[model samples]
Target: MQPKLPIQCPSCESSLSVTQLSCSNCSTSVSGNYTLPLLLQITEEEQNFILQFFLTSGSLKEMATQMGNSYPTVRNKLDDIINKINQLKTK
Candidate 1:
């Protein structure tokens, strides 16, 4: 399996930069300082949540039902995710 790209440093919890990239087909490598886009910096769990939320037609009630979580809980999680994304944008 291909290793997933990291968007943050596990050690210090700082945003990660994509310094090197390679072509999978021909093994060509490129290196530079590159910042991970804010959207891409979102955690995998958040990504899954976004996907599921869209799949459920943006209905918090449906998300709660699908995840077996309370409606308020689902809403709160969504709010928190939105806050995090907004914070990233301000930086």
Candidate 2:
């Protein structure tokens, strides 16, 4: 599998734009500057949390139970993720 592309620079913390894309099956290529979706900009840990949240039927209580944390903690994390997405959208 291809590795996940970096959306943020590690040094300056700037956004990275995609300049090239190709289909592995057909080898067809496309080139342009493309901004990754906001979802892709978040950390892998946050992505996994999103997956876990969906797998648990989007229940904060269930996520807390699965993660051995409190419901408020899970809710806060979700809130932070949402707020970050919102901020990114406004950019």
What TM-score does each of the candidates earn? 0.84, 0.89
- lDDT on C-alpha atoms for all candidate structures: 0.92, 0.91
lDDT of 2 by residue, 27-56 (tens): 999999989888898888889999999999
Among the numbered candidates, top lDDT falls to 1
lDDT of 1 at 24: 100
By summed lDDT, which 10 consecutive residues of candidate 2 come out lowest? Answer: 2-11
The runs of at least 3 residues in candidate 1 whose Cα sits more than 4 Å from the true structure, single-residue gaps closed, are: none
| Per-residue lDDT of 65 in model 2 | 94
lDDT tens digits by residue: candidate 1, 37-69: 777889999999999999999999999998999
